[model samples]
Target: MLITLIILVLAAIFFMNGKIRSDLVALCALILLLVFQILTPEEALSGFSNPIVIMMIGLFVVGGAIFQTGLAKMISNKMLKLAGKSELRLFILLMAVTSAIGAFVSNTGTVALLLPIAVSLAASFHMNPSRLLMPIAFASSMGGMMTLIGTPPNLVIQNTLTEAGFQPLEFFSFLPVGLICVGVGTLVLIPLSKYFLSKTGTKEKQRGYKNKSLNDLAAEYQLGDHLFRMHVAPHSPLIGKTAAEADIRNRYDLNILEIRRITVPQSRFFKTISQRTAPNTVLLPDDLLYVMGDFDKVQHFAETYRLELLDTHMPEERSAINRNSLDFYDIGIAEIVLMPTSGLINRTIGESGFRDKYHVNILGIRRKREYILNNLKGEKMHSGDVLLVQGSWNAIGHLSQENSDWVVLGQPLNEAAKVTLDYKAPLAGVIMLLMIMAMVFDFIPIAPVTAIMIAAVLMVLTGCFRNVEAAYKTINWESIVLIAAMLPMSMALEKTGVSEYISNSLVSGLGVYGPIVLLAGIYFTTSLLTMFISNTATAVLLAPIALQSAIQIGTSPYPFLFAVTVGASMCFASPFSTPPNALVMPAGQYTFMDYIKVGLPLQILIGIVMILTLPLLFPF
Candidate 1:
């Protein structure tokens, strides 16, 4: 027990220091417990198969789909209209909507979906996003208190009750408490956020360089004038020939960007197919080749190959091919700056074999302020020259990893996220609704974990996410491992008689004052511990003790358990107390003092409210 206590204290110190990852710290503590024979291997590894852990993983995928399909963003955008131009209205609506979304989605994901929107809205109102962002982060946590699967701490308490042979909580058991939390939070945060946050503006200089949009890069290179499309005519010499066989770049100085083929299915609807212009890619009859070159060279190539030139000078066509054409679903463009130490600094684009080596076509080059568009194959590469390259999004992403050669500007993958699967929004919405119904209704016969698994799989199979790997990327392994590692500590505490010891001390100290005061003691203690460690970890450690304390005092454990969960979640005085709080720190230009000034008051106020309200809701 002494060793276990020492390990726990060391883990708390490491978690609070934040120099190392919290997950790593927890795992170390778990290993210490195992090494000391405090827990057997089976006991140590049981958390991996815990239903709470499985459910949390599933929820991450479900919430990721909701974000990827733009469903959450669309909902929030529509709701913002109700706020009009009133700052007070926007503040209230932001809290309400964020909390509402946070109930269904992970608080981290809820903040991610709403962060940019909040910033944009604040910009529109001529206000700093700092005023709205911190409050939004806090509201996300408040929102998580509303649902059983909304937050990890909620799941911890629920799992504790189930293992204790108590009546399991219903889906909406936390709803009233969640409502009170949001109410109290909203009331307390309004003036606090306005006064503290409005005084600080976003530190744009600290954010580093903001990458330009694809359209901006295209315009600067004047790529539209150099880009042309040619349709393969009958008996064309280019028919059935691969790009390598035709040697188009050498013969005509024209670079083929991609091949677009159209086919009419049995439904008689024409479907357009776009493929990257690989060396061995075969040219089919009637294929439309998108190429870049001087107008004269493009015309010359068309005449030489018996292909018909298609006019793209119309406003709609030009706009479509420029703005809407590269939807980044597959093919995309990005700028890469050549390094001074690059091996190909003095080599021409053709001599460097960029197309053969990287499988991407260099459309244009920017040397200092000069834009070189035509005959790019012969344009010698220079240090600090920015090349506008177009290829498969995957190819562009590969360029980013070549740090020794050049720096791929902006985030290529993040740019792809902007191109959402909006078509799947309704399908994702339906899947979510069905999952919620299954969890909420007693007749469904589906366990909550089963419901979440079904929704996560459906999100992937139904194209709510891009693919399987994309789905996997949504799960936060750190948090999952952290919670899994910390769960065994709770069992350890119970088995070693630490839970009884702590509960006895708590009860002996506060039992005479009535259950209300004892409940407050548990609530405040959990909240205080959470300020230093993860809330989920705090809940796992303290939940068993809270239950034992209630049992020893001869009162219902529900209110005591409720205090544990609520206290664990309502932490806000420190930035690192919760992921949502840390997520908004840099964007909000907030310092440690900012969180202390704004979040401390709200945290105490909500703790007091929950202490007064939990007993009424659950009965002592």
Candidate 2:
């Protein structure tokens, strides 16, 4: 019992520190328990095969399919159009949509999918992004309260009840309280959000000048002063020569940024091939060179080599050049911050061979308050340095996968045009509806887990996702591992009589006040614990205790279980409380105080609503 308590305390400390991954913390606890013979190997490993875990895996695939098919994006677009221009109306619509989608998808995925839309809407309305982002983050959490598969805590509590020899909560059992909270939350947030957010005037002024274009990016990095475009003449000495042979850098003191190649077809037969500049790339007739050099020197060199200087100041001409120079259909632009453990740290960009390794061109580097644009090849990389990179979406996606090395920032709006909406969207929607129906109405006699599994397989079979591998990659493995590792903690607690002890204490202290107060006390305690550690972990630890407490007090466990469910999902007081909150922090430019100011009141309001409503619905 002492060992289990120590492990739980240490795990909570580690989770609060936020330095170690939550899964790693849980795994370490599980390993310690196993090493000490606290649990048999079979008991410790059971979570890996739990039906709840399997169902979560399947649900991840379904969510991924919905994202890949752009159904979520389409819904967001429609919602934004309906929102019109009023900030209050937009806030309500955004919250409603995010909450609805969040109930079915991972909150992190829901936030990622809608972040671009939120930012774009904020821009169109000339409002500060901070005004809209936090609300969306909070709304996603509220949304997860509505369904069984909406959030992991919901499943954890349901499984706990089932294992306790009680009937599990139905699919829509949480709906009434969840809907009431969301409705009440919307009413409270519409007017109160502005007071907690950053003042609109300063933030808007700072962001209003922001533009998304290669040239604009270059300008921001102070590269525009020397950037020039020169066209290769048919008879020029560089016409038939490769970049290495031309010795443009050593001879002319210039670096070629890109090569713009435009092929005019004799008939409608061949397609154009756009390529980036490299040493081995051979120059051809009419090839436009985007080079960096002094204006006068570049002009003199261009005249001496019979090259035509293309005016870049003209917007239309620059746009045309960009269109024909790079295939934006397959390319994207993103900013990635180097993490402390990045391998590239202390290595010069040239030494690291960043372009060659990642298939991405480093456009500029932002370190501290300075932008390193010129002579970036020799600049040594550092942790926290942001790299503005341009590359194919596939390459960017690859970079994003290496989360240990880099943290990809906000949505790359420049690449938004390239995301082709999958045609299988309707089919994916139908499959989702069928899955919901199977769970809600028992239209299919199969277990809920089987229904989810079938939906995931059908998503792949119908090509709702690009491929099986894509669906596999979409699963939140960290979350799965964390849940699996923490499951054993519940077992350890029970074995040590800790759950019974805690439940007895709770009932002895609060039972005289009646089951409603006991329910409120459990909810409040769970909510406070979740503000630090994961809500899923909190649910796993508290659900059994709540059930045990109800039994001790001689009351039905449904209201107590419902309290645990609602409390675990009320993670609004801290930015680190939920994945969606953390994901939106940078984009929203929010502080710890922002969450406390906006979320604390809502948390209290929801708690009150839950205490008042759970008893009415479930009847202790």
Candidate 3:
């Protein structure tokens, strides 16, 4: 018993430190228990095959099917249209929609789908992303409390009850409490969040390049001054010469951005079209040279080379010229940051052959506090250096797939952004609804696990998901392994009399103050522990103890179990407590203190509501 307690305490400390991954910590504790002969190998590994774990795996696939079908994107578009230009309406709508979606899907997955939408909305409204994202994260957690499969902790609570010879909770058993929490919580959070979250004034300097125009992009990176246009003359020395052969940078001290050559098709009567240019592109008479150089140097070079200079008259014309130069349908500009583990680090751009390999133009590089726009061919690439790249969208898509090499920043908000919804959306929706109906009505005469597993399989068989492999990848293995590994700790507690001892101690001390005090104590303790550890792990550890305490106090265990469920799901006080919180932190530009400022108060309010409401419903 003493050894078990010591290991659990050490595990809690490691979990709070955040240096080690939570799954690794849970696995280490499981290994220690096995090494000390505290649990047999079968008992320690039983969590791996638990029905609850299997259901979570199935639910992940189901959620992925919905996401891949672009249902979330479709919903986001409609919500934005409904909210219009009102920030308050947008905020309320986003929170309500995200929460509702989260009740039926993985909260982390739901947040990931909606984050880009939230970021785009913030950019459009000139509001801080943090102001919107924090509430979204909190609402997602509240939404999970609405259904059994909304989160892993709810299932874990039900599993504990079944193990103790009690009837498991029904699928929609948590709906009433969940609705109350989500409704009241949103009412409190909508007004209070503005005070807690940072207000980044009008899009003076948004984090990424999502909503900026071509001219805005150029000015931000200081590329506006160097761009110029020159026309190649009929008798120019550069005519009939390829860009590489001419060596424009060496001969005229200018970098060629593009060459606008008019091509005449054999069948065309009068149409003249522009073609994409490359280093091997041959120059012709009347071809426009978009070059980067000093105005005086460009003028002198034009005179020396017998070329005609194109004067910049209107900014609108210049913007049009710039926009028309790039084939927006096929090409785009993106900002990509080199990750620390990138293999391209320490190599100069010239040596890396990035242009030849990736078929993208490296416009400039931002290293540390400085932007390196000149002499970039020899500039060595470093981890964390941001590169502005222009290329075909296909090439950019390929580059974005290599996450280990670079982190692609905001994709251009314009262009044919990847379609989030497909024709399979209706089919996916139907499958999800059928599964819900089966669980709610017990139509299948089988366990909820069987119904969920069948729905997951149908997701792929019906073509909602791309393939079986894609579905498999959607399951969060770390979460599965962590929950499975932690289950043995609960079993060990019971076998060692640790659960009984703790329950007796709680009942003897807190029971004198009546069941309401005891319920508050259990709820508060679970909520507090959840702030620093995995909520699922907290529920697994405390559920059995709460059940034991209820039995010792001679009352129905329903209220205590329900309290544990609510407390475990209320992990809002800290970002590290849940995956959804961590997922939105960077996009929102939030700090540790930001979560505390908003989440702590919200957690307290929700906890009070749960304490006041659970006993009345369950009659403890």
Global lDDT of each candidate: 0.79, 0.73, 0.74
**Candidates sorted by TM-score, best first:** 1, 3, 2
Q: In candidate 2, what are the lDDT values of residues 464-545, reduced to their tens digit? A: 6544677797677776776677767767876887765764566468867888889888988788767655677778778888
Counting clashing residue pairs in each candidate, in order, gives 0, 0, 1
- Model 2, global lDDT: 0.73
Model 1, which residues run further than 4 Å from truth?
58-76, 83-91, 101-177, 191-213, 229-253, 261-273, 283-288, 295-324, 334-352, 377-386, 394-445, 451-475, 508-511, 514-600, 611-620
Which one wins by lDDT: 1 or 2?
1
lDDT of 1 by residue, 1-620 (tens): 78877887787667556677667887898899899999999999987898767876787788778878767667657666888778899899989989998897667656755775686678667888899999999999999999997888888988999999999998888899999999989988999988888978545463554777766767777767777877788789998899889898899888888786543322211113445568788887877777888889889989989998887653223111222233455677888899999998999998987788888888888888888887777778999999889888788888888899899888767777566666567777888778777765668899877988898898988777766888898777776776778778777876787655664576569877889999988888888767655678778877888888889889899999889988989999876677677667656766657787898899899988888878788887
Instruction: List the pairs of residues colliding in candidate 2.
Output: none
lDDT of 3 by residue, 1-620 (tens): 99998988887777657577667888999999999999999999998887766776777787677767766556656777999978889998998888898888667656755675676677667778888887888888888888988888889888988998988888889889889888888888887788877572234566654555544556767665677777787899988888778776556656676676665433122223353446778888878777766788788888888987766542222121233223333345678899899899999887776667887778789888888877777789999999987666667777877788888776553332332325467777777777766654534686767778898999888766544776787677766776777767777876787755764565457866878898988888788767644677678778887888889888889899888888888878766577677666655656556677788888899889889999888887
Give the Cα-based TM-score of candidate 3 against the true structure: 0.53
Worst 10 residues of 1 by lDDT: 315-324
Q: How does residue 314 of candidate 2 score in lDDT?
A: 41
Question: Cα RMSDs of all predictions?
Answer: 6.2, 11.2, 11.6
TM-score of 2: 0.53
For candidate 3, list the clashing residue pairs, or say none. 70-420
List ranges where model 2 is wrong by over 4 Å.
98-176, 187-418, 446-448, 451-473, 513-519, 522-604, 612-620
